[model samples]
Target: MEPSKSEDIYKETKTAKVDDSHEFNEAEVKRLSNYLSTRVIEIVVGVSHKRTFYIHEGLLCYASEKFKIQLRGYFKEAQTGKIPDCQEDPELFAVFADFLYHDGWLRKRKSLYYSCEWVMVSRCYAMGERLGSKVFQRECLWKLQHSITLKKFTIANDALCRILKATTELPERTTGNEDPLRALVLRYAAGQISTLRKDPAFKELLDEHPELGCQILMRVTDDESDCQPSGAPPEKRFEDKVEFL
Candidate 1:
């Protein structure tokens, strides 16, 4: 017996949905297969007791154009299938590798403002900048800003100085351009200058990075509203704090 019209309609609809789902699955499988089929390269990080990471070339190149060119072009790294002299910290490189595979930073727990995790994230930001990975840099900045504003986490003077110094060494800084991380630091410092000034380390930071002093001064002069007491809620909205992001 022939099926009823309603039954035929339902069957057609279910078949179409199944076909669409199959197509989506096929696309995902193809993407995964491409990544897996690519050659694996050894990434040697750190100086002493160097930690090595075996990564697919396609995934690494997809995340960083610098690596793409270095590995694909006629560079020594391509011939050896290994990057033997990466100077970045092994722990930080682990974060980068995790991000490449997972699309997010892997942390055991949310870090406090004054924790060493802050410095780690800052270093990761600098490393991301060097690697030409904007996505990694953006995620790091977002994490920093989120902790500062929403968690009401105040950056320690030492951490601030470390971040400032790291950002200052980036290639963009040599070109006299203020990167987003540097700008965010200056903004936060300007907002909490009165409290930061009491710390001797803060004074030393200004001495070491005179340009930071000038920028903070300019920010304070331009927007006195950003000058909030230390540990107080930010005067500006979170969005205003990280306009670059």
Candidate 2:
């Protein structure tokens, strides 16, 4: 199905907060996105509904982009009694919760791994903007709730993702960013790759795929980088490589 006009928040961000001095720090918004990534979707969903906040993904990201400015606005309004709230307005909090939930979910999904992880990092920093240290405790709760086996499964999947990213040839040489890449590498190091666990065959495959975690320590930096194509040249004909079932 085609996405609804309501689902698109990227455009809204272009003019999201036109009246402000534009002094809000976007980098801070991105940096703080992760702390909220560990939250349960149910919790955020419940909060968003109860609060009547705009909780869809794109709007949430937009809210993050406008976080600092709106945050300042809220605080100022509170002091002046113009707004009776110290917490997020319904719309704002919903955006925050949606951003947090989607980002966290994306960060966890290996298949959806970011070539650059912009979504991942952005989600985290956005959460920090809303809830602060409380986000950290929620993350800890997430860790506590999951089993070690499940966690390991998650890690191994992430490792494969990282390895694929680092080894692939980007359409653009560089996006100058790392989203899922950093998290993926960490997952690999932390034993997320099941193949790395006890299967030597998978280990060998990983050993050969240089494109994994493609953004970090890219081929440009080293003489031995796997960015070089495989020794076997491309086949001139389909029959040369295709095996029939």
206, model 1: CA deviation in Å?
A: 2.7
How far is each candidate from the true structure, as Cα RMSD in Å? 18.2, 19.7
Task: Show model 1 residue runs off by greater than 4 Å.
Answer: 1-33, 106-114, 173-177, 221-245
lDDT of each: 0.65, 0.33
Full-model lDDT, candidate 2: 0.33
Best by lDDT: 1
In candidate 2, how many Å is residue 135 off? 12
Model 1 error, position 163 (Å): 1.9
Estimate, for each residue in 1-245, the C-alpha lDDT of model 2 and write its tens digit.
Answer: 23323223323333433334423255333433333342211111223234333233222333444332223343342133222222333443443454344344322323332323323333333333333323422332232223222333333434444334332311222666533223334333334333443555445544665334343334223332111222222221111233359
| Model 2 / residue 32 / CA error / Å | 17
User: Where's the lowest-lDDT run of ten residues in candidate 2?
Assistant: 231-240
* Candidate 1 structure quality by residue, lDDT tens digits, 106-211: 2212434565777888889888866767767766776766566554666777777677666665554566656767676677777778887787887887787677
